[model samples]
Target: MIVTWAFGHLLGLKMPEEIDKNWQTWQMETLPMIPKQIGIKPLPKTGQQLKAIKQLAHRKDVKEFVIATDAGREGELVARWILEWIHFNKPVKRLWISSQTNKAIKEGFKHLKPATQYDALYESALARSKADWLVGLNISRALTVKYEDSLNAGRVQTPTLSFVRQQEKQMDKFRPQTYYRIELEIEGQKALRVQNNPYEIKDQQEAQNLIEQMKQHSGTVVELSEKTKTENAPLPYDLTEIQRTANQRYNFSAKKTLSLVQSLYETHKVVTYPRTDSKYLTNDMKKTMKERLQAVANFAPEVKEYIKAGATVKQKAVFNDVKVTDHSGLIPTEQRASPAKFSNDEQKIYNMIVSRFLTLFANPHKKLQQKATVAFANERFVFTQNKVIEPGWKPSEDTSETTVQWQKGQKVRPNFSIKKELTKPPKPLNESTLLEKMEKFDLGTPATRAEIIEKLIRSELMERTPNGLQVSPKGKQLLDLVNPSLVTPDLTKKWEDELEAIAQGKFSSNKFLKQIEQDTKQLINEVKQSQKKYQDFSLTQKECPKCGSFLREKNTRDGKIYVCSNSECHYHRRKDPKVSNHRCPQCHKKMEIIEGKNGAYFRCKFDGITEKIPNKKDQKKKMSKQEEKRLLKQYSKPEEPEEGPLSIALKEAMNKED
Candidate 1:
């Protein structure tokens, strides 16, 4: 029988403390907004779990080791890493299934293919890992060194940071300008959005004149039109879609909820997979919905009602064999489960997956729209309204997101007449909406999007705002420092098109990797050639020596410093730097380490205590030595002396006695 590991990573990585000295400082953070990276360190149970994993991986009697992981990239990698770390040499094959029923699992095992078939998938995953390691490690180090602060960086992170900072700038500059328009109203209807322009009256008094003019005029419909439209149930919820929605609805951070969902997939085995970007099942998966639905009869009693409702499971809504690439879209397995082990966040994700499953077989959601134009004072006003004629897959639920839009539209215009005004910001790009946009552009996959967001945050290239992602001051500086082409979404899109080619065996990973390597080098060289000096807002009492211009503190993507006023004129030589993980000795917190005209200093992340590196390191080491200076604990403890001076002296006297 195959053995299992605990719910954790088993190996192929150094122990946390071995990787870095600071990890031994096991003092928990006062504020645990994030799970510390080292907290991922395997526990004692993890070791026992790994022993089981290894024993299973090494069984010679086993004909073919089945890679039975949650069907996604991370799941694949997690299993692969364990096999690699344990040096398991058994022949391998994949047992792929979406649902949790024993029948599905057994069928999948019977249909298992050689593990080598997934080489391309593994290759892509490895590429992601190596690229993240190279870029995240190197760029993060460079920034930390320059800033004398522990700065984070990653491939997706820096650009994501830019995306956010851009929004922040927009928010900062936003000034709401009021506008006025004449609206025509009927006995039962409200006004609609038609032509909007300057008020008929120029001044506010004239605007009051327009309102008065509208008050004097009667309303009449000049034109009317009606149309009907149908929307299939939304495609399956990919990981990013789930993440974005979860963040929006529950105020769960993107990263926080990701971990929760991951556990739901791997540890709980209730969800099919959480890291997959594909939202459609392969054609084969749709065939077993009845069986899949039956498996969950214990928890969601609603499934039986659908079967009773004469819903015939259709192949059209199920998986498309041609569309399935490396992984299939997420779905819940047919496993009956108790919610006892699930955290609140996990329950939300579970509900979403189950609801979507039930929705697939429901009828098509139908919408009807009516648009009308009112001609008054030779100026036209337009009104529009949509009513849901039939709720398709979303039958039981009175409202979903799409439904809300129509509902809100109706609420805003109960009378269905011409409206005076309807002005709203472009739908704010929260985590979910942005991913939708990114997917539309085919910019990146689910596995990579989270990393991109994480990288931007770690690098301080962007940060979370109440509104959404925003670019950091440093992110702006770095974007300007680097060539524009290096950081655009186009870079990933272009790479994705090529990656798709490689997946089809039309191109090679080696060729694409080579091109990317070359591009990265060129990008770095361009940044190095820039003559821009570092600047910090705090460093203001100086002038550029060469330009004789007042030097002001400035913040950049790389760090902080002072530079010349002129952008084009020659000023200074370039220097490289890296971020430190070390905390400030004085403030006992991670410092805002920076490099520049003033050289390296550690400004506390919390306290704003700025100190040089020597002072920082010395303070910590000295503090540790002082804390260990006492022998009182040693004296009180049992079986202490190994070879103390007292023992040594006794040994010499004892030797003479012998």
Candidate 2:
């Protein structure tokens, strides 16, 4: 059998202009550009690859084809589209396997299934692509034309942006209330407020009185209890879970984590598929546990003990066929990895996958929990602590044990103080938190979630800051101006449910596309009729040099740029001067090259020093007296130390201390 591959889909759905000439112009009259039938066209960049595949299919010796792309819906669509585009009528077989290990691939070819079995999956993928085009492109066009602004609204991304906006709104309106709680410091352990009726004082005077009263009265232990608690090991890493963990731990974006994991899967072949949603393994995979563990043990000798202990483990939660989908939870393959050959990033991600897998076989974590309640001045205060009874899977856990000997009705003297705390607002949604919400709502699949997040940032609907992800002013306005349904997960959830049904052959692709077309028309009409006004929030005071139209400041990977607000005028330039190779003699840093009235010049941002770039013929020219005087005058003023918010806060704190 001949093995062939295509770099993703060589042919994509036809563009609007390809379908009809009218769609070349962005007009509300041509809103919802739903073609009579969605057509396919070869993408220009991958045309050569497509031609090679076509040539291979046309060879007389090649009697049949095997679809061996990714073993999921999108993968199925990729192979099927290529075959259809090539117009090959030969018989086709499929090789579906979750992992790319040599054994799995060999077994997959041995049990190759017919291509017809995956026809429904291809249909589902087609329906998704068409629906996204009909809804996303049309609405994005409608909003841009109606408001005369660069705006993008989508089925999944808009809702995801709405989540960030909602979180920001909650934080904006949050009012912090001051509450006081009195804690007793007895033998270093601070007593906690008891549940049901916490010792929280709202009034400062009342809190002070209670603190004084508690200090006078001798405290007595009213209740003491001890119990054993067991926590089961964490389930294996699904794609989303690993993404979240990596983001929280290393501050890696969802896209970055996915790429790293994909490299570990596709390039190194050390792990299973990186795009699974399930965290459970199939029962058949249980027999391969020993070999997989031995491979991991070779790579990470520290986990060898866990692997050995886990080998005898018969944990029911580790394996469940019902929870698995197209692929199982991500785990190390039977191939032992060579850490020295992998990049630092790949090693980090690989360790996370392997670490999670190790936890699956180890014993449950057992701890001894102790609680003590004390009554002082008719108020109850409690303290609870846990000591590990068994390290189990998490041997690195904090197993520090502390013994507190306090019997019921025992009298004790303790000092008390009131702690003043203000209620805190909810934190902004970072990539990690946002992915969790997206997964909870089923906004997108594991493969598409990272892309959906990136689309929002690229569209400038949301931005990442030190605090977390926040919706831009344009995004906040888009949420108001767009159809309300598009900003909620409900629409995408409904479409996804139907798409799944189509994949199962319970729904028709034609009917699904028809419904999407109808919905697109309705959404477009709503956008066109809405009287809500949109302002270019990023509009700069300057006009475009090319078209005299107002230019909007847009953030890009290469820093900021000023793009003409007028949709027709595509004039754009970088907002800042380009940094040149010339280094500032004083600071040894790269200086920005600017075009001055004289000629090209280099300027240092630190001390406002400037230097003229001499031409080749005038390379020996020395600095003139006037230029020397200007430089001295520019640096004459002594620079004051910058006082930012942190500095000012530190000053205020010092004043308070004084």
Candidate 3:
């Protein structure tokens, strides 16, 4: 028997606080927009985690150390990296499981994979860490120092930034040409198209001309076809889909949602493996679905209700043996969660995963899409409508927040009433779609997608303009200066394909590492040798009023600020509008500093007004009398006779007054 103790991921490294004093400083941000780099910082409490891991290793009864993280590349990385850092040298096994119930964990342990089976996975994972360190840190620091601002950069972020930047360029070049579309009302109801599709008039003038012609002509009914099409149930929630739906519903950033979901997975133990790419479960899981459902009766009332009613689980969409890869899609387990264990966001994510899983074995949400064409005079129009005939697996009760508490709800069916027609093109990529694209490109996986999105935004290499995430001027410029491949998501796709080959033992890890090394060498040379034109928009010269010398305005954490280039010259002023710090009367804490075109000013960061401090000379004069009084008072007191120089100054000032 292996002396195995299960604990969370915090056991292997330095506490996030001890790792940097700036951890708390950076935490002051409203969001996780940490500037600098995008790689694993290995969270706080790492040392404690290592102690736990080592403690397990030291146990005499433990025969084999099994690395049982979430089942994926990231999972492998988490456990192996922890082991490596902690000097755990023992025969290791991989305890593979999806949902962490007693049964699932036991089953997983019983069928533990040979440690050697995932050497490729571990290699790829380590390579990713090292690569991110090399590229993300260098590029991030270069940008931050060059700009004198804490700008973020990363392997994934640069490509994401490029996406936003490209969108911006397209928008700038866009000419919003007016286009016209026509809709016809038949009797009281609006008609779209019968068989032929609705028409879009590309030219407004042509559309007007056609409208004029249609007004005179009498259009015959060209064709009318009405058939029901079924919209199958949505596939189960994978990490990507979960992030996507979370973004759509909650407006949470991709990274934020991922964090929430990760917490739900690791903390709540109610949700399945979150970092999976697959949305389908394995064939074997179908047998244990009942047990899994029974296990989650506390957190997921729906599961209990369905089970009590003896409703069978539906299988086609959510679970397919063929679709299951390294891991299956996310699902709930029997690890009972108290309501206290979850935050609001965690509960929401948990609900989503559980609902999708329950719905999968239950039924398909079936609706009949009916299309009809209504013609007015000679002008033809098309009309379409939907009628949900059967909510197969998707009982209305399951969809409703209030449960029906039964497998089958009332016999009510879906009815459709649709009118009006408008021609609209496919919408451009939103965050969710962009993240979906990321999955395809392999720029980042499900775990890294949100992190990349956020990293790009923090760097200002990308921006979320009114339209969407687009690359910024800085991002594009950096892409031009740096190695093209590293800055592009395309490299990830290529590497992932190769890594996949390696995982299957098709390609050698050594060969892959060699290629990465060669590529990195080439990239380094290109960055070093290139004489690219670098520009700082802030460095635009502004003449200083005090010394009649040009002062360089640099962007700082407090925004743009002017500082004299000559180190000896002590001229400095705020560039971006910012109020200065003043001690608040109530809290006695330093106030916020604000800068504007006029100059820097202080305002109490606390909820109160602040007294202003004037120029250096004025401030010195005001403080001089007070400082002298303090010196005199100190000398008069016999507290310390060691008050030598200050006492002499006090005596001289006192004698002059006398």
Instruction: Give the candidate number with the greatest TM-score.
Output: 2
TM-score of each: 0.66, 0.87, 0.69
Per residue, candidate 1 scores C-alpha lDDT tens digits across 74-103 of: 566667776776777768888776655565
- CA lDDT, every model vs. true structure: 0.60, 0.87, 0.63
| Cα lDDT of model 2 by residue, 70-133, tens digit | 9998999898899999999989999999878899899998999989999999999989998999
Alpha carbon RMSD to native, model 3: 16.4
RMSD of 2: 13.5
Off by over 4 Å in 1: 4-64, 73-90, 141-152, 196-220, 295-302, 313-319, 367-369, 383-430, 437-444, 458-461, 465-467, 536-658
lDDT by residue (589-629, candidate 3, tens digit) is 76766654576566775675645558888876666556889
Better of 1 and 3 by TM-score: 3
lDDT of 2 at 291: 84
